[model samples]
Target: MNRKELEQRLRQELALPYYNAKIAERDYSESEFQEMKAQLQADIEQYARDYVNESNANG
Candidate 1:
């Protein structure tokens, strides 16, 4: 995807987990909350890598 597309995708991808994480803080256990947070971080890293690789390829 292009940079703009990537930005939009990243925004959508990251939003739900963040919203859930907010709710999860109250409902999920400590380990569960940590897992959710870790997954979000992983998702972010993967998206960054994909965006970089895609951008490089497009260029």
Candidate 2:
């Protein structure tokens, strides 16, 4: 997927609850959030690099 699509999918995935909540809302922990952020950042950078390389080769 493209960068925008990838990011949008990630956002949707984050909204999904991984655990059940009896009285409180379910959400990601600090480590989980950080891991997700790191993955997103890496994917974004890879996408940008790929795009640039493809454009250069096409030209």
Candidate 3:
């Protein structure tokens, strides 16, 4: 996928209900929130990469 599409996908995937609850309840401090978001983004990016790799390999 292109950069734009990948970014959009990441945003959509990052909107998890568990995280939403944490944000709504003020469960984490600002730095903590940022750290969590950063990690989640990294994880999502890796997952996307893995999915693409698998698809290419299968074909």
Give the candidate number with the greatest lDDT: 3
How do the residues 1-59 of candidate 2 rate in per-residue lDDT, one tens digit apiece?
43444344456655533322222334545565567557766876899999999999999
Residue 36 C-alpha lDDT in model 2? 59
Indicate the residue-level lDDT of 47 in model 3: 95
Model 3 residue pairs with clashes: none
Q: What tens-digit string does per-residue lDDT give for candidate 3 at 1-59?
A: 43333344445657753332223332344555457568878887999999999999999
For every candidate in turn, the CA RMSD to the true structure comes to 11.5, 11.2, 10.0
Preferred candidate (TM-score higher): 1 or 3: 3
How big is the positional error of residue 20 in model 2, measured in Å on the Cα after superposition? 22
Minimal lDDT window, size 10, model 2: 16-25
Give a tens-digit lDDT track for model 1, residues 1-59.
33334334435655742332223113344555456557777987999999999999999
Model 1, 32: alpha-carbon shift in Å?
0.5
lDDT of 2 at 16: 31
Please list the residue runs of candidate 3 whose C-alpha ends up more than 4 Å from where it truly belongs after superposition. Answer: 1-26
Considering lDDT, which of the candidate structures 1 and 2 is the better prediction for this target? 2
Candidate 1 global TM-score: 0.57
> Which residue ranges in model 1 land beyond 4 Å of their true spot?
1-26
